[model samples]
Target: MENLESENTPNPRNPKKPKVVIVMGATGAGKSKLAIDLASYFPIEIINADSMQVYKGLDVLTNKVPLEEQKGVPHHLMGIISPNVEFTSKDFRDSAIQIIDDIISRNRLPVIVGGTNYYIQALVSPFLFDDLIEEMDDCCLKESIGDKELEYKFASGNDNCNVDYQRLKEIDPDAANRIHPNDFRKINQYLGLYARSGLLPSKLFQGQKWGRTDNFKYDCCFVCVDASLHVLDHYVEERVDCMINAGLLHEVYDIYSLNADYTRGLRQAIGVREFEDFLGFYLDKDYNADTERIILSTEDKMSKENLKALLESDNIPHKDLLMESINRLKANTKRLVRRQKRMLNRLQALFGWDLHYVDSTESLLGNSYDSWPRQVVEPSVDLIRSFLHEDNCTVPTKIPNAVASQILDKRDLWTQHVCEPCGNRILRGAYEWEQHKKGRGHRKRMLSLKKSKQYLVDKEAEAVT
Candidate 1:
């Protein structure tokens, strides 16, 4: 793609930099172990790419790497935000890029490891929010009033708030086909941009060049952890059990007390949601007992005793109830495994990665024929090392200290110049400005504003020719 060079670089060889290695896989796929093993041999820092793990106080629930497990190796992007705060992919991309540059400056290999596919894609893809937002902004301001009317005016002129798939089809047929019709968020993002910018988000991203042309960038290999259906089911069951033993119920209870929004976010989490149900049932039993005791008359002693005796007798069937609970847990675990498998398949297809099925093994070193450690783990590490050393492999171009220092200084200068509204580094082009205004959140904000009288007046003035 496009390469931005430092002015002081007289020779391309012997560049002052190291490669970035990314380790990606599904949840519970042993990514952390592989990352640690690779970091042991190289001057590497692990950057957490998981979305949920970035939040604080979710160490056990999110499976964040413990401080001791870091093995004195630096880890970035973990526990940086409170659980109450919502994090978006753009926020992740900005932080990750800054950290990656810092790591390279220190001559350390940046190894990004996580299961969050969107965050990883944001890092590797040529599409940057800075440019996209700029393009969207310009488009949003320049569109003809007539054009906006044609786009926004549905057959019934009902404002078309749900997103128009047909508009997306006109702009990017491929994207329209890939995105489900019911996926309102993505659909709205594309359609809303098209209505304002007259350009599709997918089309804006197609074939765009990236400044970082490091061979290591494209040379990065993806190794997906695969397992048989039965094995995966068993693995999920064991994992859920471990989570419960780790006090997942208590974690959910703690989160529930924070706020409705916090509870909603936790409920949306995988294992946390199931555990919340368990907690809800437990609380409901206590609530029912309290309600009964409050409503029952103390003078009706015989009736109250009969009711208490009935409940006590019913509660005696503990073993049967425990068996039922176990069965339900097993079933839920199976469902979760199936969902994970589907998500893995979808991400694998999108990224075109090499999937390696690793059999369960006790040790990292075992029989090459049967174990994940021997067959998948070691081979991946070998590939990373080979890519880093190969002469033809694209290492980031080296720059002289003077030129590199100048570029770093320029970056800092522009840091404060970044858009305060979108919180991204400002783009140089008008086209990019237009794209940002049409992005999902911006458009959603605009629509929300249109409902208010004061905002309506401002919007009207802005729309005036």
Candidate 2:
């Protein structure tokens, strides 16, 4: 590996904490722009930590930095996996470690960049995720649930897993009792493990990586880029507009069609699975490829003729369906922003050592938002370089605002978010969150917020002093 001295050094004998750099933030906090710019000035090659961008295609929706913008810097692990395949956190950690070590050996700074926070944690803190979750199917049960049915049950997200919980209790009561009836996700895993491996997740991991062994195989500094919430929402809205203008709907349709109703692994990408309603609208019905094209065109803002045809053919207004997709995309993204903020909080709580934050709100709200300036990238790059040259304290547990952390924690009502601006409106989910932002009351509050210049404290950052 390169002889670059990292700020946070582990035990000399530990091979885990290799020197590396990381850039992370919410959905539209300019992580890509800053990363590419840093690469321009330093000997850095970006190794993607984003789960969605690792898949091929859907560049616009994923908000991938374009080649022309990269300015000839090499980026690894981006758009390489097939969207049809399941790419887990483990897949990323394995692939990225190999790529990072390779870059270091080439005398280049290996920079891990993306919104996927878990991947970053896995890199710097070994077994960052719960060790019980198996990376691949290890259980060998005689009778297993079919994939489609399993997917349906999981996706349904109801509290109907009580029976499975009961069955699991008889077989593996420890694991079953640990999971809640409503948490089908955990229940399914517990039941599935016992059915296949005749053991609980904890028991199955007899010798595998589990618990804190201090074996993180890389040394890294996480650059958390952020903006005020009001500022971020505007940026997100602008990106959504750019996505729409850049044929986002068509991209979703193309990938959705290509996957042909088998939306696995990559379906979690922001916009893909959100199109469930539109896709399900035609699931049982069949149409030729050409007819499918005409129907899809109706959703395109540019397809005037298709719009006319849609109005004439279906009793429901084409505008309504298209708006449904648009509304969904927007709301889901806002919730993503919220969730990402929470992830940042968790990171702050767990590994506060040598973690630096770059708040570029004023710059992002500058006369030109997309135009990169020194303010955005220089400080972060300098900090990273400093990490290479200086000795920094190991990650600490001194949480900034423990009290605020408790208050800011989200209490979702069946995956919901509450917006205080609009009649204390309860946003049922992402679609409602996005639409609420654009609604009269929310926009009115946004303008008020901008005028007041009362920057919304990053809800998650409340964990910090």
Candidate 3:
């Protein structure tokens, strides 16, 4: 319910160090536009903090700023890495800090913006990697290194430990289950943390000072672009429609031809992998990462009529498939938005005074400042200017209970299952899940599962007889 609130923290904006503005928001909350609009008020270059946007290609799925929309403002870290390479949060922190320093040297502002909560959190806060990397440098902390040089010490870390994802599960099941079994890099990190430091990765991470990491020390403020849940849901659908209109299918197909691994890097982008079923349905896939993934059916050779008939014969409606992709994408995006809201709340709880909130509900469809009323936009811009020009600025800090309740005590929300026979609605909590099980729809699924099992058993018996 509070309007234009900010937190006053210990961070003092020094003239020597460059001022950085971090824009935090969910997928469709217009973060990019806000960062660009700040250029009108101050000299600013954007440093992208989104994980997917770090990779090259699949721009549509990443919601990258198209050339026309960039408005000639210089941006860094967007569409820069190969899709096949695994880019981690530590890599982002190191690279972004260097870039921020460089921008400050040139007397220009560096603004960190995007949807990846972890990436933004790492860059804006005291990151776990800073401690880990520093500890690695200190031969005193790690006995296994035993006076060995920094570069050579961790050279054979994986081989020496022979640790894998399973070991991580034994040590830290909570962290392991959240990560994919195939994410060996993170698994190794967790394993290394435990082996060298005698600390759980999860505990080390939580115990670190959030938002004020020692290595990445820059005077910064967080501007969160937020909206009502209903409004964000609407914008997500609109953005998806725009992506569809902008040839998202062809974009994914283009990356597919590159044989990018979905389990790693940019190919893991939401829209890219979600359309795999549709792409696999239409096109022949020889998509091995080590080999070329060429499209066998060229547009010139494959007639629309022929493709339609083949899918029809297979009982797969092209229109229906597209709709299903759209719907699934919407669901995933909305879930992401919800998670983002909660993560931002974490920032508020930790860095209470440094975070600021800007209501973007009204500015959904238009450019940043122009879309907002003069009253709101002017003061907001002034607040930012004061941060940039002055040492510190004071603004009211407010956290609505409604926002806090949105994410409180809901760790298992994502793991909850939906009742497929009961309209496939998501069960968000244990109570909802229990209620669904007791409801007619869940009972129907139970009956269906039972019947299917019985039918299989009967068929086997008949074969034996």
RMSD, one per candidate, in order = 17.9, 11.1, 8.8
TM-scores vs. true structure, each candidate? 0.60, 0.66, 0.71
Q: What is the lDDT of residue 177 in candidate 2?
A: 42
lDDT of 2 by residue, 1-465 (tens): 224434333446754456777788898888887888786567788888888899898998998888898888899988999887877676787788788767766777888889887777676656533343353344333335446335434534445567666766676654554445566556666655544444455455333332212344555576878888888888788888778777676677666653344325666688887665664453333446765632333442343234223324653744566667767888889888988886675455433334577777877688666434656776776676666775442333235445434422432212355676566665543434654676676898878877665445554366575
- Full-model lDDT for every candidate: 0.55, 0.64, 0.68
Residues 1-465, model 3: lDDT tens digits: 111113222225523334578887887877888888777777778999899998998788888898889888899999999888888887898799899877766667788998887787666666556457566656555876444333333543545333466677787766665566677666766666666666666766645555532334666766777788898998899888888777676676566534346778877778776766765665643455555545464543443335324423654565567567778998899989987886675556434425677777867755565656453345567678767656664555575544433434332322446566667765544544665577665787889989999999999999999
Alpha carbon lDDT of residue 18, candidate 2?
60
Among residues 3 or more apart in sequence or in different chains, the pairs in candidate 3 whose N, CA or C atoms overlap within 3 Å are 7-353, 125-211, 125-213, 126-212, 126-213
Candidate 3 segments whose C-alpha is farther than 4 A from its true place: 1-18, 130-134, 137-165, 172-183, 212-216, 257-260, 284-316, 351-353, 365-370, 373-376, 400-465
Candidate 1 vs 3: which has more lDDT: 3
Write model 1 residue lDDT over 237-314, tens digit each, in one string: 677567656655456555642113323332445544443343343333322344342232345323212322332355
Candidates 1 and 2 compared: the better one by TM-score is 2
lDDT at position 240, candidate 3: 87
- Locate the minimum summed-lDDT window of 10 residues in model 1: 1-10
- Stretches > 4 Å off in candidate 1: 1-18, 128-131, 139-184, 200-219, 257-267, 284-373, 391-465
